[model samples]
Target: MSLDPAAVRAAFAAAVNMDAAELEEWLETPESLSVGQKKDGALESVGHAAGRRLVTLLRSDPGALDEDAYRLMRKAVGFIRRHRAQEPANMVTSRWRYALMNWGHDPLK
Candidate 1:
């Protein structure tokens, strides 16, 4: 099924209660953007890596991510990144923040 990028971005924003622009900025930095590589006229290596990391994190808990939740998160990250010109930092950061929160961690703390 095809996923809508805007919808994915909006869902991410709502889930994390963050400013989407802030996340977009963070995603374009040298660090994050640098991880991506050209592939089939698209830059998805970085996003795929990010999604896999999230999946791994959830999987490690053994019961954290059911099939549907895992699939949706993967789809959201992949679809949004694929459809955007500039990377979606807001969506990326929302995922990162969510992961950190899941582990009782904090970037600011």
Candidate 2:
């Protein structure tokens, strides 16, 4: 399935309980933007990596995320991690899993 970059960004903003405009700045950072390459359809491949980073941010910082958003982010992260684990051979999933690990969260755990 193809992923829409806009929708992923929107959902990520909502998940963090941040205004889309404010979130745009964070998303534009070199690290975040570098998650995927545009030439390889990185939007679809790297969307989950971006989401993982956001979730990790919220997780490591206290009071940075509202209770509801925290719960939703956890659920989303868990779901994505689980899905990626189930499809170990898929390149997109493998990349996402590696990204999660690089960010300090192990998808297999």
Candidate 3:
């Protein structure tokens, strides 16, 4: 199945408790991110990190993402986990993971 940017954004916003408008402003399309971009410091925001991950995921084949894409996805999962941990009562984690799985990515990995 094809990746849906709206769905990805919605899932990310839910997972991070970020405003969808804020996420839209922070999210850059996959084509805009340079290959040389560095991931050094803590991510700017969960929304930004999740948006980056979604871009990477969209660019790759879900069944076999390249190493860099996989790494990005893993980082996204980490960011999601960190945010989710802050709100133990929130049920968005499972829904977010389910969304990812539907896009052919098993974030559990």
Q: What pairs collide in candidate 1? A: 23-89, 23-90, 24-89, 24-90
Q: Over the stretch 50-104, how does candidate 1's per-residue lDDT look in tens digits? A: 5444434433443454555545554554444434434336744554543332322
Q: What does candidate 2's lDDT look like per residue over 1-109, in tens digits? A: 1344345435544333433343344455554444533446446334545454554554454445455544445555455555455656654445555444333344445
Q: Which candidate do you rate higher for TM-score, 1 or 2?
A: 2
**Candidate 3 lDDT, 1-109, residue by residue in tens:** 2444445444543444323343343344332232122355543433445564554455545556555554444555555655445443443454444333322233345
lDDT for residue 34 in candidate 3, whole number 0-100: 24
Clashes of each: 4, 0, 0
Q: Name the candidate that leads on lDDT.
A: 2
Q: What are the Cα lDDT values of the candidates?
A: 0.44, 0.46, 0.43
Show model 2 residue runs off by greater than 4 Å.
1-56, 84-93, 96-109
Candidate 3 overall lDDT versus native? 0.43
State how far residue 95 of model 1 sits from its true place (Å).
13
Q: In terms of lDDT, which candidate is stronger, 2 or 3?
A: 2
Q: RMSD for each model, in Å, please?
A: 13.9, 11.0, 11.7
